[model samples]
Target: MNHQEVGKYWNENAQTWTTLARAGYDVYRDHLNTPAFFEILPDIQGLKGLDIGCGEGHNTRLLAQKGAFITAIDISEVFIQQAKETETQHPLHIHYQITSAAELPFAENTFDFATAFMSLMDIPETGKVLSEACRVLKKSGFLQFSIAHPCFDTPHRKNLRNAQGKTYAIEVGDYFTNQNGDISEWGFSNLPESMHNLPKFRIPRFTRTLSEWLNIIIQAGFVIEQLHEPRPSNEVVKQYPSLQDSQVIAYFLHIRCRKS
Candidate 1:
């Protein structure tokens, strides 16, 4: 799908995304991706930052609370509204806008750093978005992002098990092929009753191979700084039992890059 179609898909699913965010990014992000990301993040005290694809501004608010003057943007109007409402509830120095990542609306070299947390895979034009990120950052500025591991989270994924039915390995297909559309169910069984009753949810996503992701950032004038493949901790598994197998299978990849 094209950028416009991708935006429309997100707009249609914004309410569900908002509900998921409100339910907390704790299980998915906090327990899984955040630790690896923060390890490479420099102190943001007294810095200007941009949060591309900042869903409901949860992570953007964290940036503000950490002392970064944040400018957060999302393509979905409903998501932007929800973010603004969050800002009103608890005042912060955050400027929120409804804008696409492919075309950022900011002066060149305006931000010290930028971030896209688990958002790149959802965007159709990854190269364009990365270029826009580079255009907005000062020389030597950094961008930290996390996404579902393209290799493991392929268009077709399956678990390989033995006679005992214990997952030994994961099987993936179409690893090198770029693919998009509503490939997976978005709604979870454990969601709140109000959320469960909502219509069937299937969000659009675009997938690129690992090399494609790296090449895009390099072409956008970035040098790779750090790469992390995070697995849920044993403690986390105790709290969220379903994530036990995640400890063995890589679920997410985090990258830190600096503008050259």
Candidate 2:
């Protein structure tokens, strides 16, 4: 139930996760999360960036595409290997390493920016990870990351649906409970019926209150710049009906902070 164990779970999930995610099974990410994260992001052309928890280098490749020199890391060896394989084929010049976010291999002020797509909340040592992110960012550099909304996506959550099987509200509980390293099992909801038999991913849950996240970011030497609760646009909802539940409540949170 520690970070090492969490890494092992991710290692087990690496191949399937990468395959499904690349195949568009991660609907929320492709439809809402990643697009929202990029909307507020500053131009990183010619900058040196570090992507912590860069599973299979999906978002890292996006960063590289924006003209940044990227070094991406993930604790899972398989994840890094898959990312490296992608790099070999595409020749993006990205550096992929098997490294924990809580213990980065780089020196202080080494990167102009840093990012953790949806991986921070999965990390058991959130504070240490943020501290390491701060340590590696240059002065005025920013760290922009996204996570499941703490208020709605608690240790216990379910979608309340109407008679037509449309989600109307979210039922969430155990918000005050400490959930460090608790195991949660679920597969991507967007997978085709033929792939319904795929094994569920065993992911470690590390739930924290919104205040706790803010305090940790401040304690890590970051000044809060922007906080966003991303909801799918009308067009997105029409395209991906499953995301309509997000209109009832924010499903994801994005934060951008500057090294102070």
Candidate 3:
């Protein structure tokens, strides 16, 4: 799919996605992605930052709380509207815009840092996003992003469970295939009562191998600083019993890269 196609798909699902973000229904993000991101995130006080694919401004708000001035952008107009609505309720020095990450409508060297939380995989032109990120960042500025782990979260991944309903092995296929399409399942069936009747939403993901991901960053003029595969902590697993399954396989990968 092309960028416009990808944007069209997200725009179609914008309402459901905004509802999920507002209701805090992202189990994987709350339990896994956020913690892993913070582990490597540097102090951003007084820094100007860019947040790409900032759906509903959830993470942008968090960044504001950490004392960073934020310019958040997304491809879906509805998503930008929803994010602005949330900003009205809880003011967080953020500027929300509707724009594509591939062609960032920003001046070069304008940001100290950039972040994309679980968004890069959904972007069709991964290389363009990386290049735009590199261009917009100031000299030596850093970019941090998280994605569905390329090594383990393949298109044909399945869980092998025992007769007692316990997961034993994680089976994966076509790990090297670079492709895009609808994902199996991604909605919160356990949302609050207000959202119980909400429509089920299927995510469209673009898959890439680990080497491809690295090469994209490197080719975009970034030096890889760190790579992280995050899983649930012991306490988190206890709180959310379903997270116990995460130990069997990594769900997300976090990468920190600096402009070279």
Candidate 4:
């Protein structure tokens, strides 16, 4: 898969994401690791917040409910459309804008908190995006970005093994990401018997190792304050013993850092 072709895939799968997330949130909470209120919500309050790649405006609407004036931006107009529809149904006043995470349209020091929930890896130009995130965050402001853990969330590493050897396996060729970015395979799951439940396809995902993820923020002049590796809850523990002490430590990291 062409690494560059993935973000567009998100545009295509925009509506399905909401459906998938809604389904996961309700039925399969065990497979999900979404932290309550965007990981760093507790650290900052009553300040301007930016939600980059605000798909379906799920987290954006959450931040608004918590009293942060938010600017929600995304690259896909289709996603924006779906997000606005969701907003109308939910009725939250999050300012939605169609924009790319790589090149934010806002001025410097424009926000107090910048968060991209599970979306940074989907954007193509993360360096520019992070720089823009830094540019807009106020001094002492926070940036909390989360992504699928690079080590384990990877498709290659994501699988199931039984006594028969391999019961279920999907493509896992794309893993390491360099300065240029990594193109990874992705797909969607349709509700049974519904062809339009979602389109299944491949796309690219970008991320750095935990060290690289941390160092970039430091070089960008932010001080790491708290690092969160959310362990699976008891339900997960009781359900999947195979995930015990695996090569992957955390499925996601909630980094709270300040631009100091």
| Cα error of candidate 4 at position 7, Å | 3.7
lDDT of 4 by residue, 137-244 (tens): 888888887776665565355455557643243334355644234444444332446545345544455556667777777887788887766665556746654334
**Residue 38 CA displacement from its true place in model 2, Å:** 0.3
RMSD of each: 2.2, 0.9, 2.0, 4.5
TM, every model = 0.92, 0.98, 0.93, 0.78
Q: Which is the better candidate, 1 or 3, if ranked by lDDT?
A: 3
Model 3 vs truth, CA RMSD: 2.0
76 Cα displacement, candidate 4 (Å): 0.8
Candidate numbers, best lDDT first, in rank order: 2, 3, 1, 4
lDDT winner, 1 or 2: 2
| Candidate 1 lDDT by residue in tens digits, 30-138 | 6667766776678999999999989888788888988999999998898899899989989996999999999898989999999998888888888889999999999
Best by lDDT: 2
Candidate 2 lDDT at 229 equals 96
- Selected candidate, larger lDDT, 3 vs 4: 3
The digit string of per-residue lDDT tens for model 3 on 1-260 reads 77777888788788887766666677777767887798789999999999999887778888999999999999989889998998888888799999999989999999999999988889888999999999999999999999888988887888888898666778999998866765545567457687666666756778889999999999999999998888787899888766666788887899999998
- Residue 97, model 4: lDDT of 93
Judged by lDDT relative to the true structure, which candidate is superior, 1 or 4?
Answer: 1
lDDT of all predictions: 0.83, 0.92, 0.86, 0.66
In candidate 1, what residue range of length 10 has the lowest lDDT sum? 182-191
